[model samples]
Target: MSENMEKTIGEVGRVDWSHFSLADFLELRWRLLHDWQAVLPGGEYFGQARIGDVCYDIQIEWLADDELAVTMSPFFPHDGDSAEPPYDELVSGMPYDTQHGASLISSRRSFLELTYESFIDLAEHSILETVARFPHLQSAASKQTGFWDRHDAILCKIREQDDEDR
Candidate 1:
């Protein structure tokens, strides 16, 4: 079994989005979007460890608006030639830092990226659904959880609005 499979049982939980800046969010989002395939579809299985191992580089190009052009490659060893096919295909676009430069590739996508946004929304909804099952985590991020007081307050407000609607 791979390290990813081992680490990926049950929920991955909420990320510390506040820690990321817009640039950081974008980078993190890019990486997560890249690794989307590695993560088992709705099955929480880790296929392999990305650290110190050759893996596909998920590439993104922003043509205009928020639409991202995503591209990927097979594992290309870090020590391999830059002119190699995988590397060539992966690095073809302009880098994100440059105007019209393809977005810089990274191991982590930024908070603003769709990757994080989708993950957070899914996690929150899952938590709301299984509130009785995972009381600890939900409470920790809930209003009753003093440690996450601010987030908890927000959750409470959301719950209040939901209740009013229903």
Candidate 2:
């Protein structure tokens, strides 16, 4: 799909959960962690729209079942893996705690909405490489950082807000 179509799909936000569910999302996370092409091995998924770059896959690891992980991709680095540091190092490098950094990286949410929303756009923009260059981040910096110390609390608030909006 073209970038315009991708954006349209995102705007629609009409997901077919039957074909794609939370379990599938989790599995995708695991597969992409090791291989970018896990979703389309042999590049035979022609019927499925290309979501992101095939060069690299961004692995999203959720430490807890209640959290979210953000993986980026469109263009990936040529190295065996991205040069970016691990989530722990990135959190340690931050001035605040891990939770704070997680929020910052996640745009103030415990989880990010990347795969289902902008996957097609990512490929069209050819920015998957940029996404892959970043590390697979987790929400480890809970309430200690001054934002919401309780990761659960933050997640609850976000979920509530989403529900209200809906």
* Candidate 2 Cα outliers beyond 4 Å, as residue runs: 1-23, 26-54, 61-68, 73-111, 114-117, 123-166
**Which numbered prediction scores highest in lDDT against the true structure?**
1
Residue-by-residue lDDT tens digits, candidate 1, 1-166? 3343333222333323343244544554544456544433322211111111112123444433433334322231222333433323222231111111222222323423455456444433432333323333223222321223333356568778889999
- State the TM-score for model 2: 0.22
Model 2 gets an lDDT of 0.32
C-alpha root-mean-square deviation, candidate 1: 19.7
